[model samples]
Target chain A: MNETQAETQTEIALDVPWNVVVHNDPVNLMSYVTMVFRRVFGFSKEKAEQHMMEVHQKGRSVVWSGGRERAELYVQQLHGYLLLATMERAI
Target chain B: MNIERDAEGGFIFSDVEASLAAMFRAIPSAADPEGSKAALDRLFPDPAAGKEAGLSAEWADYVRPELREGFENASTTVEADLEPLNAGEDGWTIPRDHIDAWLNTLNQARLVLASRYEVDEADMNRTAPYPPESERTLAVSQIHVYGLLQECLLQNLE
Candidate 1:
């Protein structure tokens, strides 16, 4: 509740990694999904293709895991491209 | 699949597939095919139109003959019943099937562009600090793609 405590909490929270996950949707094509992963995360073609396959077979995949702020931004960007995307804390 | 260094020593695609893929993802689907085709015409306007004469050659590439023709065709195919409604007026409703169809088309275009340009998805994200003109084109293309999605959603509501 004090300023020092609040500041400490903020720093701690900022250090936690958040996970960015893209959910499989019937609407988006596999190729488009792969391209989005490449474009948004700068993933290599092979890596992007792997993730795309995971999404297709597994129904979803955690594409990126990083700071919450960055994760949120990635999720938003993916959504902007009409991908079904979300973010959550990595367990 | 070959990468070369640009004048600044940064990476550049020998093939344009990645950039093309990005653009394709940003195009709207043809719904009510005729209406979509018409809308595209109004947006892109003319074929064989040149980019402003003085612009750099790279910038000029953004304005292509196919762009005008594609828009015209897209506009005609999109549904006209979904035209933008005024404030306080009820908007058109989009059907779930239509949304799915549009998304499918967007995905197909993405594939075509990527294959045509021979750029992988990861390469697209890795390209940092895009030139201003290229960035502008991507932004504009995204807006158009989103607009089509919005239109589909509106139509389904009607």
Candidate 2:
């Protein structure tokens, strides 16, 4: 492809959003999950608990949605805390 | 185990088994690259879902090293804190700053036990009592002990 086409494709790729999700697991405690959510995303107690509840009740929660790089970073951070987390391209 | 917060806000656990503290010290070395793959795999699964093999590989390549570093750090923190234990005192103190480290390490230990026992999510939560002397019963008890520890840390953290 030509340079202009390559540059345009790069920009489009960069604009595609990704969603960072945490899946509920039987092993992790609810409180531990809440604390991890607060620590990683800097969510307030209420917000973090809400997401924790969502994961508990709904099986998964979209904790963040934004640029792919940032989403990947968030997923990695969650995994570091041993949270079951993943990222997917936004539809 | 009995847990309470000190005046400085750090957590102290009374009745912590000397054996358990030794186990924490052993976690970092227990992560043998070959033997511990199954446990590590569960702890840090492929971040991408479905048939996205290429994406999963790319993500793993980028993230695995950092995850390894995190595991080492957690194990080190727990070891340092437990260094004072000499088999006499069945207890340990977790400074407020190292709470996260303790949480991560304890959770990892639980995951490793679950992996070793071949327990699924349902089995881990199975309230049905195993025969009292069975290894499964012992495994279940250990897992719950880790859960209680995590809960105590969370309560004090708040």
| Predicted model with the maximum lDDT | 2
Task: Give TM per candidate.
Answer: 0.40, 0.85
Candidate 2 lDDT tens digits, A1-91:
9999999999998899989999988788888898888889999999999999999999999999999878878888898888999888887
Candidate 2 achieves a global lDDT of: 0.79
lDDT of 1 by residue, A1-91 (tens): 9999999999987787777777665435556677678878999989999999998789888898988667756755664454666666675
What TM-score does each prediction get for chain A alone? 0.86, 0.91
Judged by whole-model lDDT over C-alpha atoms, candidate 1 comes out at 0.49
Report the Cα lDDT for residue B18, model 1: 49
The per-model lDDT (C-alpha) reads 0.49, 0.79
DockQ, every prediction: 0.02, 0.74
lDDT of 1 at B14: 28
Which parts of model 2 have CA positions greater than 4 angstroms off? A1-3, B15-36, B50-55, B84-86
Q: What is the interface RMSD of each candidate, in Å?
A: 16.2, 1.3
